[model samples]
Target: MSVCKHIRNQGYSQREFLVLRRWAIYPHPSVPHYTNKLFTHHELQHSDYLSQLCIGYRHILFWARWVVTVIWRCIFCAYHKLFGRKYTPLPPIEDLALVQSATTLAEWIRRGKRSAESVVRAYIHRIQTVNATLNALVDERFAAALEEAREVDHRLASLTKQEREALADSHPLLGVPFTCKDNIKLTDMNHTGGIVSRRGIKAEQDAVVVARLRMAGAVPLGVSNVPELAMWCETSCTMYGRTNNPYDVTRTPGGSSGGEAALLSSCGTALSIGTDVGGSIRIPSFCCGTFGHKPTSGWVSLEGAGLFPDALNDSFGIQVVGPMCRCARDLTLALQVMAPHAAKDLASKVQHTDLRDLKFWWCEGLDTPLCSPLDPALRHALTAATHYLSTTFEAPLEKLEWPRDMSIATLMWNNKLRDDYRGQPPMTVDMTNRKGRVSLLAEGLRWLCGRGRFTFPLLMMATFQKLLAVNEDPQDSPHYWKPMQEFLMGTLGKTGVLLLPTLPQLAFLHHEFVPNMLDFGHTCIFNTTEMPVTAVPLGLSKDRLPLGLQVVVSPGQDHISLAVAQALEDKFGGWVSPVPVTV
Candidate 1:
């Protein structure tokens, strides 16, 4: 398309105008001397004009990102100046039960060292104490949860030691407490997914994963918050406002599983159930200083929980429900309860692998779409870990390589979701409901005045998704998606693992993701590959917020990633309680 049509199609926003003017006025250093010296009137005729114009456009777009960043940073500063520290500070974890892992908690409850009722009550109190500050626990089932706890205690009291061992094998987490993300239904609890129109809705039944956990004797504490339809990375919506990070309430807790991570980090719950499509589960875990695992594709059921389709695995991957926890071992325990049929086999695979037999590869970000640079703290932490692994384990941490050409990565992803397929979401008309698709133009304009029914991030998502030019020949590009999978699977093989910064940067202030939305490709691309990943909290940054990295392994290797997470926990402390970050 020509520049004129491009501007007309874009509607010439302020940023576009600035970019066009800069492109026309600037003389790129790489341009020949004759162009600047004698071709002022004949520049368009120059051989490099189009290529240089493309370069100049890219240059201006790069600067435009920073300009948007400065603008958002200023808004944050003004907010603090006016609000005078409005968010409440979370009290440090004072109860011993709140600090223990779900795995340990359950063992204690079964062995009679602790009462199941007391453990449930401890989490209930912590959630009550922090929800006012974190806005994470959106709906509670405290009374019901307490009742369930009593039953667990009563049942265990009658069981013989041999029976308890059998119970431990059959129901590993019997008496542990866990929170559920709002999108993952909890019977009689809020199921809004942060959409204002869906405000009064409640779930009639537990999601499949939730049911499994319940059957295993785990008690449900509450439902956590989410972005609209679980689309955005930072958790906030018109219905539930925004969920804040406990370490620094001024920043985000990453979404759409953000609420669960924040609650776990703040000692509100030892474990939680959350769904991931892009990096929903891992991103929040990264920001909150907790552990989260996105299981191998189809390893966990999505029934009654996920809004996205499952066919993405056969075509281009997208959704799965997985466990998020404070400690790494709890991830293994939770997955066993959630997918008991596959537990024994997976346990055997994970136990057989040794770190010495594994190879390591690391990548800063995806080669296709541009990601914001990793924060210095994130970079330093990842580098340090790589160094430790290479020296401590006597393995080389080599740089990862991408396929020769991956420009089609974004198109393939968009086409898969946009194409007609079974189980496909109603993206043809987003913000959909019983009423139907919303008018993007109308809703987007209303949002400008701060009176819209949807959040800006949700609208932004709607706009970008609709803007993808429909692919009339999606069949021709199925081959394009293969290179990434082949490269990842072939290189990693069975026992190999790849390391990546959990995200490009540490968690930013709420809404700051608007300008850098494309960065999610870092996590989304992995989802498309169906690889299993565990987000491990390395430690705190200089600013006291969480710093983390992704430990990705070949498909069907969920346990390998989990095992590595446990090893990391031993080498570097995992899931430290968040302290207030004055900054």
Candidate 2:
């Protein structure tokens, strides 16, 4: 490849401009940079000059797209400014804090470099100012939070420096503020689950996830809002008004985790928690332009989730309690703090882990019974991610086949056996056994037996009450359960990890239904797989809404998932604050 040919191939014209000797040689002190720097007069030939012209033409064509991309982004931002959603009294820039790879907000607070009182006060003030409009937070725990901050500060003052450092590493969340989906129970707070029936009810004990977060030193700002029964995608309930996107108030923040997403995106809080039976966490994160994670079922203890009081006994399949944040580091940080695991056990596991050595499989599109086209922006983001991921590992990228029959199993586990079943259609249509009848009775019976019960009528009544009490569909259990097992045993037959788009579109209109709500098959399928899935923010949508990706790893391999999420963040832009500086 002579310099002249390279230039011609790059699309430079012959005779129009000579390739001077100074241009072709290296280290020319100064001879007009750009094209001239790569070629010299002696190296140029008539044959090569033609090729250089072609090369130059191609370069122009390639960079032209980038120019268009920037122009498009500018136009989108301007439109959002003019007629899209808007927020009042934008938050101060100082409130923004970047979460470290494996430390939760609480951990950030506990680090003591930042005042717990300052963090708590900032969030409390933000909530007071903006929440009324967004309606993202249903309950405010400001007084209690102040008291907790006082205690945290007192404790930190008493500790020696080394002890403080060790404690910060162990419990980084000590003073950080956070919020959780209303569906999860936190002692002393109402566990609405977005249902009017449960309005007055408060948890008798912290849900396991809540307890873990508290243990890590996080102060609760209050319970964030969610959709009714968390069954819908937009964040609106009889108890709380709809949550709107911070980028554009008219558009939806994304649900069932919309509240958390909205609050975090607006800088009302640094990090938060969201539950995903389907796309609750990822949807809101993507819409709000943040990050969220849906861990494998049972990876995070569901013992205290307000939904289906008996999470252990019910077959609630796809439902998972996970972290949602504006930054990928915050997602991993929240996961480590909330998921049920002994500190000693996790400590031992973290001793011998390396992210670079891991294997990751990227699946942008799936061929399945629930196939649908992804939005152009989302598609491009996922494809770009796949390209970037290849360099992380020294292995080939393989496209995995989606099992057509898998959705049937997923529907069953996600919808069929929910504790809240009140004659509603299950999330999946697989209520029929192989015999082809809606033989859900047998499955329900098995559910009772799985909980160690055999009586049909009494068990049915108990299930019904559980459903009513927690406001979860009793049918979703079977809908998510069977399919999850099948998905794990089948397509994911391999041992490593997989990646996929978090949602098909950008943040949707506030209170609008996804054009095709059922397409969340991508997210729900993983919920069925019951594997720990890490949601990492890749970038913004073509329209400036957030876009994210989920990394699904084998069950109980949470450490690996966290590692992979951290690695992805290292390579891509994880979370960017919605607040922008005018200067």
Candidate 3:
């Protein structure tokens, strides 16, 4: 048998075999290069002594390479820890226009207190000045937005005072500049979801929500960035790149709506539309210290949101399109514009439950291993939020125990999502090879060598999906989900709200989220249960990073969550502008 035959028999590919041969024959100059010609020659392929020597050399090289790689990673991490840029103290905000909520901005524009063009220009100038450091806006329609703003001015000017009042009542968001998550289609903008391959793919028409917002007289400024396929909890991709938290440029803004959250945090846009299935909207809101809402499933249409094929079925009645904004009032305004049919009935019927009449349940943390212990700051924030609500509303707060089977329930929901892509191309990893199936070990090695193109979190999700795909039913298990859903709904029925931690910690440093992915369970659980949740900012931490809590209510009770969020916002200064960090 020849050396090539030996490698083939050992299950190594021709390419891999050749590479190994080269490495063994030409070992690093600093290391001993095995100079035995017999080891390289086919003539000695069958010789037991030479074969054993070659095997031993290969093993030694493998271990040596791994050790060196580990050492390099350690050094890289250490260097970043020492020299990486962090967020600096923010300057006092002098521009009241920048901090004004969408509702207030619209009111000003409608009342002739501010011109539409001026408001739009102020945001454009701010975005231009800070976007270089934040990288929040992936696409800008500034020129078009300005033109639209001018048109809005002309329209308002043409109307009499009585007509303007009527228009304001009808078009509440009129002339307000807002943004859309890149995944939420805005006609002619890239709907890339931060995937390099999807760049330049423009939406032919606005998404349902986008269309409605446009009709409501709001000008679309542009689209924001997201993680690839909108998969991770941190915003980054090879296309538009990573978005930094305006509060701390070194920390993540969270994802897949991270860019929108960062933009809102920086006051680049007063209100933005984002989608959430597994906490995409709320997590970013928490990280950026902005308000976000995930409406009851099916409240907002998913049309024109660039989801993966067949995702609608898997995530049916689970994912939703909602709003992220600087103020909770804007959430109700945006939701009304986006989901008018549902909002009309829900908004009118949504009587504000007095704090005295409302029941409050708080869970400091989850019972599952998937969740990390809450950061001390986050715990304090939650506690403070609870106390404020309790004292102000005179609402009694009780500790609620998380379901012991919550982890498995989450997994079962995810398993159903995975089945949607069953015969499609694998998302991040290529499991199929010319030889046969590729091992995850080999793929991981390829990733370490910089040969893999996928991001680490994406690869991890792909691996998870592949593992869960086995023996997983395409249909969701009602046995697991039904009872869980019923229990959650029953607990929060009518006038009850659940206060839960939005995330285990504040926005992590970029690339630091790979290990902390499991902590996402904090938000994802509500998604699984199809509950409406409002992510309410609890002001900045002592370190100036954002802290927050999730206000969860039963399905169709979006107004309940939003109301709670507003009360919290009023008590705790909401959405403080991050002190701009120099890149």
Top TM-score model: 1
lDDT value, residue 89 of candidate 3: 38
The TM-score between candidate 1 and the true structure equals 0.85
Q: Give the Cα-based TM-score of candidate 2 against the true structure.
A: 0.70
lDDT of 2 by residue, 1-583 (tens): 4334544565444552343311232212221222212334444544465445444554464355445444544565576568764447454445444323225445555556667887788778877777867888887779999999998899988888778878865776778788887777777777766654456767677777888888888888888887766766677654565677877776778778888888887778877877777778877877776767777565666676646553433245456777876655565556667754522345345335564455557766443324334567777777777677666565456664442223343344334334323443431121111123333366475755664212232233234434534354443332334433454444444446677776554665543343334556667666655666777777666556777777777766666666666666677777766666332
Model 2, residue 149: distance off in Å is 0.5
lDDT scores of the candidates, listed in order: 0.76, 0.61, 0.75
Off by over 4 Å in 2: 1-92, 96-112, 311-317, 340-359, 368-372, 405-495, 581-583
After TM-score superposition, the amount by which residue 304's alpha carbon in candidate 2 deviates from its true location, in angstroms, is 2.4
Total clashes in model 3, counting residue pairs 3 or more apart in sequence or in different chains: 1
Candidate 3 lDDT over 282-354, as tens digits, reads 9899999999999888878888886453444424756788999988888888888888888874544444545
Residue 75 in candidate 1 has what lDDT?
86
The superposed Cα distance between candidate 2 and the true structure at residue 419, in angstroms, equals 10
User: Number of the top candidate by lDDT?
Assistant: 1
* lDDT by residue for model 1 (15-108), tens: 4434433343222222222122112324433435554544455656546655665676788767756773587778766778888889889889
